[model samples]
Target: MRKTFLHIKIIFCSLVVFSSLAQSASFDCSKASSDVEKKICNTPSLSKLDEQLSEVFKPLKKQRTFQVLESEWLENVRNTCESVECLEDAYNEQIGFLSPLPLPGASASNEVKILPADKIYAQSSRPWKTVELAGLPNGKDVVERFLISAEVISGILHVVAFEGHYDVPNSIYRGSLYEYIDRHPIVQPITYTIAKDIGFQGAFNLGNNEEGERYAGIMGGTFYYREKIARNQLRGMAYKVGSGTQPQETSLLLQQWSNTFENAKSGLLFQGDEVFGELKAYYPNTPGYETIAPVDRPEVGWNIFSPIWSKSRPVLYFKNGDETIWRANVVDKTLTKIVSASDQLVIKNPTPVDLNGREAVVYLEDYILKIAVAPE
Candidate 1:
């Protein structure tokens, strides 16, 4: 009963906050008539944010993208967000997008936020195939609709290919767990190579509060997918919502993949809601494995979405082969084949990096792409 009441109260408050349409960076609280206006007047955070946005809007108006966003865009977000938390999130996202890149020769901060190469959002891609699976195997076929796309988090780009299926629908059908698990759409990894010098510049704390911190350059090596290996070299910044400028950094702590190659006794994961997906999340638990795991896959390269962003439990890259790469747990060291492999493709000179959290990127076959793995 209490949970029900709390949910109701939350909705009420959300309604109370969106009852108005007039907004500005700085507004007269006394004259505030709408729920949004009143809340902004009462909330110090909102007021300060309004002031900041007011100042940012001036310079941002000159940009091409910002003009398209317009007042309706901002109003729609503010009005649609029912809770203060959601509202704040909407504001921050808007500001991030509206914030322009730094000018040439602009100064940057001395401190740098160094993430493992994997955490850095590098350019990535994956082979995509369409399939329709029964929500409950042999039960009913309703075209379980879903979409997969690359997303940027904390200023990093990530794309992960993963097997999709309905979770165990109920306990009565637990007897046929394996058969019910559909591993149809196999998610592959995006791979790329870094053969030369690499660099990471820090974010510039532009001398003024109005502009805020401009995203520093996120330097990624050559990015490509299977066929366009030579012509697909890609690098530079990938933003979640804003423009990222180059940062000032002396050096990047590199985790170089071994020129030497080795094979793992088994694949990284098996496809099942219970075990397979869970195991891939926390891979590379061993210390110093980051430098060693790159060469340990099925063949010449690694599969996509095998590596995570942490030092512990990183899945090495593998070359694609005629074998259907199976999923396995690191503890028991057992492997399960979701689908049979064809003699078409093989893994090759695989390279990988952590794209922050559980997502990682692998470069192979002269192309680059993203993969899903354990979260950070």
Candidate 2:
């Protein structure tokens, strides 16, 4: 796993500064000159300390465990006391009877594998086949579906992969199913917990009818089971895996090229001036679409093609008339167009498409070149 301690530490420091100075005189901790003095000044609030510890210790709680040995131990035991013969039969004939024997081999202990000190049990399953896309700019490629097993460790669900496969060049690529599981969130479970009752406990009933036995629940209710709950949660923990839910007008289009990509929603690339002087609307489903500015920027030099969720940045697909060039974001979201000769460049009239949920903007540096415009 990539060490994110430095990043976390930086965030921690920033929060400390914001809380101390940005609020009021009562919240100020600027009086302390040294780190030791600051610690002394902040030590009075044990409750605050407890809350902070709880916040940080949640992931640790999932990691800690206790062991128990299985044993056949019962507090109380009882058996039928005595047997009596019928009064009438005893009087008539000599009463004769044989004793019954007690059953044996029922004193064994049950064994179970306990969870390790640093994990919680969760299950995930995916499709059986890999969906391949042919003629994907560079070449034809295959992407596979996957199931993952994950556990919360250090406040993050680290995906300890055991299986998966991908169709690469000539051979199949398989192994280490969730290589980046440590970074992504367990969105659905966390969201469900927040939206619904976190402490609520319940069960499932299949039903008593014969038809119900075949299905989970039909006309009647059957067996009961408890729902699983997870702790150590984060805010805004929603799942977003595809681009279909988002509007198409934004420069960032969700490209599902690799399973490793973090926020698969904003890596789309079109023309440099794709949204040049056009009216666009933000997609409601997008997290920060409302904050997008309609104002334009320089199209030349460096332009951010997509949002940077993490280290993995967007790749650029640039075309000046019939000439086309492709380059990956080497430094964050900043794009530097590379110059090249136009050869087997494919240019067709862009079917007047609607920007469903997102708006577009044309940068100042890029000249508004028409789709039919050719270089002299």
Highest-lDDT candidate: 1
In candidate 1 the C-alpha lDDT for residue 189 amounts to 18
lDDT of 2 by residue, 51-103 (tens): 34334333323211100000000011001111122222221221111111222
- Give stretches of model 1 more than 4 Å off: 1-25, 28-31, 70-72, 103-376
* Per-residue accuracy of model 1 over 126-221 as CA lDDT, tens digit each: 331111212212223221111112333343343322122222332110111101111212222112111111221111211111112322322242
For candidate 2, give the lDDT of residue 182: 20
Estimate the TM-score of every prediction. 0.24, 0.19
Candidate 1: residue 187 lDDT (0-100): 24
- Clashing pairs in model 2? 63-117, 63-118, 207-220, 207-221, 207-222, 247-357, 253-268, 283-357, 297-364, 299-365
Residue 77 lDDT (model 2): 9
